[model samples]
Target chain A: MSERLAVLKTYKLFIGGTFPRSESGRVYQVTDAKGGWLANAPLASRKDARDAVVAARKAFGGWSGATAYLRGQVLYRVAEMLEGRRGQFTAEVAAGSGLSKAKAAAEVDAAIDRWVWYAGWSDKVAQVAGGANPVAGPYFNLSTPEPTGVVAVLAPRESAFLGLVSVLAPAIVTGNTVVLVASESAPLPALSLAEVLATSDVPGGVVNVLSGRAAELGAPLAAHRDVNAIDLSGADAELARELEVAAADNLKRVLRPRPGTSWTADPGPERMLALLETKTVWHPTGSLGASGSAY
Target chain B: MPSSPPQSASAASPLADVTASDAALRRFLHGLPGVDAVGLEARAAALGTRSIKTTAKAYAIDLAISMIDLTTLEGADTPGKVRALSAKGVTPDPTDRGTPPVAALCVYPDMVAEARAAVAGSGVKVASVATAFPAGRAALPVRLADTRDAVAAGADEIDMVIDRGAFLAGRYLEVYEQIRAVRDVCGTARLKVIFETGELSTYDNIRRVSWLAMLAGADFVKTSTGKVAVNATPANTLLLMEAVRDFRRETGRQVGVKPAGGIRTSKDAVKYLVMVNETLGADWLSARWFRFGASSLLNDLLMQRQKLRTGNYSGPDYVTVD
Candidate 1:
């Protein structure tokens, strides 16, 4: 056979379901865990973070208003797509975290399972978090969990594949659109996942993956007036504190990860509830008569 | 501050004699210097890139907010919609009362009374789109009646669409006569002539039409009707501004330039403002001489103003739905 040339992959940001280069026209050198030159990832600037927030906010309306059953089905389809590309992710996971092939495959396996776990919770979260309250008056008092609009998520620093899925699935399965800053040192796997998300039933802008510095991307998002909440799981101590202070201006719900948090641990409904708002509705009921007892 | 355009100077201006006949009007309009499309567009693009930051940006935001002609011209418009738009024009941001009121509240002729009442004592003027706007296909008598009815209903300004069919057919005299009639019916209400540049097809035609409107006694030469496939673009706006600038220099009668429609973001508004500052100097910066016939542009300026005030980026949730 004659000598053949190879076509290299171009790493671009997945925003609003399309791969666009950084608006600043800046790209940074990304290296494998061994500190060897790997590829160039788009160095998303403050403007890109601004654009991601806009996209997330635009998608929030349609995604949150969709039926819970539909969201669950869409998220489950993401897992199915991820499974189809498990080999590719395993290689990326190995390069990203310097893990053995077996360990990387295991991480990819757990990530797919994490998606399945979160998908199953989409329709059931409201029941677990909401209930009808007992009131003395003839009124029905009900509390339901609602998505807190656009959320800015900082993916975990390590465990790039599994950790990314663990944080992302919870926010989206609960109907909150996300602008997620991928792992700064190992953003390739997360960027690859964007392809999976696009092909699956996951809607555009539902999960925007920006590969850049967490500090650069997170600051604007936390203080952004339009963002309803922020999850600072991957932020460092200094960065997290700064973001929390900025988030206070808009009264944004903040979800900062506690120390010693493990991505492999059985993630309870805590992450999902953090990105949700409790809306308690009160409806007046007429006195019991021909209609029987009031609800 | 620049003085207003002389109302009775249609006969007194240097170019007044040209509008006396179709042949003369065509000679003057066509004889005018041709536009360099590439150069004009490059200048506009260059001006668009100037970074107006810090205090300068804050001032521009407030200035843009005040210059907006808060318009809602949908076929499904109601009295309630006009009142809400009036409130928004009067005080664009409810959270911050320090925000400046917009220049005008623009609506259909039928909604003028409602808009006038809603913005009654506020400095915000009530502008009505008349003269069979957007198409201008009706007969001259009907179009004039539309203007008279709008003015009678207390419209502070009249936005009329020029007959593109007549203008394109080289019937400048007919188009000029129609505008003069509408201008007479407008009376005290300032008349803004809409060329709908997207349909004008060429820059030279836009320049000629601008001069035609100015000579026919237009208080403002507007860019578009906000209903076309293409509306106020930067290149077309720059061409219009150049026309108004040249007209003022020759006739000593300053005409207002309003780039209406499709200008939705604060960034785009600032670029137009930059063009105005560069092309017409600071004299046309205020609402008296320059205006943006826009609906959503107000909210974006407010969001940017809020962002600058608080040192953080803002979202759509903070701004009202309108």
Candidate 2:
């Protein structure tokens, strides 16, 4: 009896809601942990990074302007989509990380729950992070945290699914659009997430995923005048410093990669708050007693 | 193109001799060589692919900035808005004094004096759109009055739209006489004839209008009124560049070409400068012989210029809100 051939999925970079091959038409061989042949992921170039920034900038206005309620629902919907694609992600994760099936399934489950965790914080983060200020003068002063435009993120290499979701969901939940550089080696899961995102309620360009060498893609994104901030969580010691220097050109808000992080641990509101800019408004009412008239 | 009896204007230094009659004008315009559409488009597209970078890019950005006629022609234009725009035109990047001021401040006739006042000592010429502008559908007297109004308000350059209805209908003499009449009223202020190329229909018509406006005494030939779906595309602009280059060759009369609408990026602006340099040579590279009739294009240029200077991307927040 003849054996049936297995259909393999083509991994492409997600930019502006569409999956496109790298502008340079270059692809790299992505392998499993034991050096087994996996798939060739799109080797995104600097131009791809530039295009991603453009898409993120274009999506910024709409996504950032959306009401917190709508943002929360949209993010929650991503969780739902990820939940349905559980089996596929589990297999990919297991293959890429050389993890047992049970452990990979647990990672997928944690990643799905992380989305729900960040989704609920969408409407409440601003309230918890900002409020009416107690000024010394007779005025109504209010401060609110606003998204800091387009954010560039480097998804963690070791913890592909959970770390990618952890960094991405937080930035977007606060109304910031993101251009994410997927992990260098285990990028299959991150690239596959683009499909789930496209199928989900998450608006295209709101979260663009690119799979390539972090060094090749990171420089342009870091130095890009349009990119407002960059989260260097996935970058190594040397690459992180290099990107931080380039990001300084535009004075981008840099979140340096920390030494060690457990993906399963509960992440506080720090990541979301890190990508936000506080806007303070002041309105004068003069001095008022019990009466409506000013004293 | 169909052959015609040699034009009376073709034989002389001055183009004024052709406006003697409508038949003579039509015969001359049709007599000009037909444009090879495929070749023109191919040449324009080929020129657009030139990779301009670094120092060349810096020079192009500055030259393009100096060639822009900073424009604001909305009905909702307030004095405050015009003043703010004029200030931005004068000092494009307030942080960097090295940034050159734009070539001119383009506004409506009513806002010309206001714009002029805002840009007095800055050497930024004030260009006013007259002759019923964008539409050019009014009576001759009203159109003539529109030119008179802008000129009287101290417009350094008067941008007048031709009656496309008359031009397309083959009323060549009528269109020629109207431009000549507006030219007479313009006096010291240079006359820039707007064809609104989107309405002109064909490359043949654009080429013919180019010759017609120049023969009628237009100091510059502008592409559009910025109110149409198609305006100042590279192919159309290249065609204008050729017309101006040939006009200078024929009559020793240099006419500037301004590709006005829909050019919103610095990269697109640089491609145009490359076209001008290649098509008309370095002589027409200055603001006197070339201009960009644009509003949002200034910010893009400024942002790009900042990027070139600092080696980083700039945002809309850094540049003025146009």
Candidate 3:
């Protein structure tokens, strides 16, 4: 234990199964709840955001291309891992959010359950929310919720662990890879969450967490033409407005911050649908269908 | 079991009164501009020949029932009352289950957690009214925060009343931006943008509000808060349903329709169901597609169902169990 503790493993940005520091090589110290030095997290730069976009884009085809059931299985696996680490998160959240032990445990459980909930939704969203469209013509039309490509999330500052998990799990479970800006004041649990994801069967670059000032890193991610959507959850007023404006550059789907609310609320099916872009396909069905289908 | 004065003197004619009511309503609606040209014609075309059924699944039930009112529930002393109603489920024994259990349980920003907890692991979802709710008179920042807080608190859905004051003042863009801002905070939660039809004061306004909400990314367009006297009516439901149907035709996105407020009986619920089925078709039968927003209507539905199943009519006292 002493050897492992003293070894000083350099935590690098997890992108495409490779460990790399920010192109700027900027590192910021993340502190624990008591403001004690915990570890140095990458102060991801604009280039790093771009790099994450590349990694996410690279992984998107294969990840989103998989069957919804397969995605559900992978997400379920992540939920299982998250459940196993519930205690660790409870302790971290207790310290991070200044919540009571019981409250922290409940939050951790809710966060884990959220993961499970989203895991279940991965395969069923289309069935419940999307279906065949009865068009006037002979076209076999259907509408389905599809991943909106690489998503960039700004995890909420409060309710650090749960918020981060809530945003990330939903995004990834729906096959949208994410670049998350971990809560500035509380980045420990986020990195810890990342560690869990690294081991959980979640593909590399499916989620990339960076710990730094939101304005410093978030703007690039929001404005990045490659990114499809920007979830501005933890950003403050000024930052949220700025990100909202920047998101317009690419017309990125922007999710503004929720007012003073925590992520412990019952998440309905809306979050999953929000990150989704509905694609209605119209396939012209002619008279040839009956003859080919007949026995 | 006592019918209300036979709706007329004739006991054999159940729908004679309805026909008269329909005719009167049609005459009243026909005088309004564009209504006679587009709205009335459209509504008549849709409601033609389809008799309103009495069962829970009846088309009339949908039209008549306004599931639950979020603003009223917000002020209710026992926040869990709606949740309990939802917990009881839609039972056939009106006397046993009280009201039919509204289509959904509505609550406030903080109460979403309580509602969700009470209705946890149940079919009924916890809905929170946000974006300053009934008034929609708040800063954009405040409204966005309110919406986000509700979703974060575990609200399965959000009912955000539009800034009618702004809309009425012709600040269309402000109203649009407000809805869009709330839509942003909604994240993954379903957003039902309320037009506050009573305040809008006209069918044309209702139509415009419905289009704005749908175009601005609303998953559902809702009518009235039930607080206002001029709540959801068949006329408003008809207009909004047409708008929703048209929006679907144009965008291919199936936005849901919720006619809330003033609905209080199984009979009312059947009316709304009839309107939806006749106007929107079979696809709108599910809870996801359609919802009633009345608190008392659920009991009425239950009572009616029980009466139908057991051949014994229960009084209102026995039906209003919750």
Candidate 4:
């Protein structure tokens, strides 16, 4: 009997909700731990990185302005989509990382839970991170947390699924749009995740995913004046320091990778809080009289 | 059909002695050559990447500031608002008196008098949008009356929108005649013909309308009415610049260009300047030739100017809201 042929999927970069081949029309090969050939990932160039930043910046206003409840709903929807695509993610993760089926399934499960975890923090981030201040003057001063515009994230290479989700979900949950560079070698899972995101209620450009070498794509984003922040969770120490310096051009909030960090650990609010900015507003406390005079 | 009948070497006005027949006019416009959308867009995008930094950037920012026609065109516009806009136009950067005032203050025809009075003593020109403005859907007489009101009310410049419906319906003569009539009413004030290019739909149409407007005696062929879904994009403005450039080489008359909408940031304003500088050379880099029709854009330019001078970014609180 003739064997049925398997149809392989072509991986494309996700920018502005569309799956487009790299602007440079270049692709790099992805392989498993045993060097088994996978799909050719888009080798995104500086131009692609710039396009992604522009998209993220464009999506920043709508996403950041959305009510915390709506953002939470969108994030939870992303989790739901990821959950539905669990089998696809598990297979892709195993193939990409050469992990055992059980281990890959566990990683995929953790990633889904990570999204759900960050989804809950979407609404409560402001409450936990901001409060009213008691000033000595006759004034009502309240500080609220606001997203720091567009973020450029370098997803971890080793634990592709869990690490990518861990970095992405936190930044986007609190309303910031992100341009993420997926795992260089094990990028199939991230590319698959893009499909999940596109199907979810998450807006286009809110979380742009690029599959390429981290340094190649991360440099332009790090130096882009329009980018408000960056996550270097995947960069080596040397690359991290270089990116941190480049990010200073616009003073982007840099989240350096913690050495020997465990992707499976329950990440505290630090990642979400790191991407946020506190805006303290002061309003005059007028007297309770019809004259509206200050106390 | 090589060119538009080899325009008169020394025509007194832009439309002094051109084709008088509809066939000739259509042939003249249609014969001006079609624009290759891809090439034109690529050229505009390429020009947009020229990085003007440090001293050159500082100079460009200030030059862009002086070339602004700070405008407020809303149905809800009040005399008080016009006065405030006029004041801002006359002194764009209040904290630093050294900053140059914008070239003009653009308003509606009815507010021209108040706008004129507000900037009476200053050299800031009062530009009024006339000829039914955002949409030039009125009769010729009514449109001509609108132009006359603005011109009589002391408008140094009159920005009039072309009848897109007429132009799109292939009624070239009606659109040309309307612009010519508006030009006659404008008299001394410069006539800025708005193509409302967004409705024109294609780059080819934008190029043709540009030449048609210039050939109809437009002192400046402007893009958009600042009221369309897409207004005054870099590619559209670049095409208009190309038209002005070619028109001058053909007719020996230099026309100005104005890109009037959705251009808000200092970066965006500078990119347009780059397009103007490279496309038209240094000759069209002055306030007399190139103008930005925006009000909020001035504040952003001022903030950038402050950033350049003070070595730190300035917030909106540092500049006036208007």
Fnat, 2 decimals, each candidate: 1.00, 0.67, 0.00, 0.00
C-alpha RMSD in Å of predicted model 4 compared with the true structure:
6.2
lDDT of 4 by residue, A239-262 (tens): 999989988876789998999999
In model 1, how many backbone clashes occur? 0
Query: What is model 4's native contact fraction?
Result: 0.00
TM-score leaderboard ranking: 2, 1, 4, 3
Off by over 4 Å in 2: A1-8, A132-142, A245-251, A281-295, B1-18
lDDT per residue for candidate 2 within A1-295, as digits (tens), equals: 8998998878999999999999999999989989999999999998898888889999999999999999999888889999999999999999999999999999999999999999999889978999999999888899999999999999998988988899999999999999999999999999899999898888889999999999988988898878999999999999999999999876899999988888889999999999999999998877576776775
Judge the docking of candidate 1 as incorrect, acceptable, medium or high. medium
TM-score of chain A of each: 0.96, 0.96, 0.90, 0.96
Worst lDDT run of 10 residues, candidate 1 chain B, spans B1-10
The residue-by-residue lDDT of candidate 2 on B1-322, one tens digit each, is 2212233544655455566788878878887777778888999999999999999999999999999999999999999999999999999999999999999999999999899899998899999999998799999899889889998888999999999999999999889989999999999999999999999899989999999998899999999999999999999999898889878876788999999999999999999999999989999999999999999999999988987888666777788776
Native A-B contact fraction in model 1: 1.00
Per prediction, the TM-score for chain B is 0.95, 0.96, 0.78, 0.95
Each model's total of backbone clashes: 0, 1, 44, 0
DockQ for candidate 2, C-alpha atoms: 0.62
lDDT of 1 at A73: 95
Candidates 1 and 4, the one with greater lDDT? 1
Most accurate candidate by DockQ: 1
Q: Which pairs clash in the backbone of model 1? A: none
Off by over 4 Å in 4: A1-6, A131-143, A279-295, B1-71, B76-105, B109-126, B135-155, B161-187, B195-217, B228-322
In TM-score terms, candidate 3 sits at 0.45
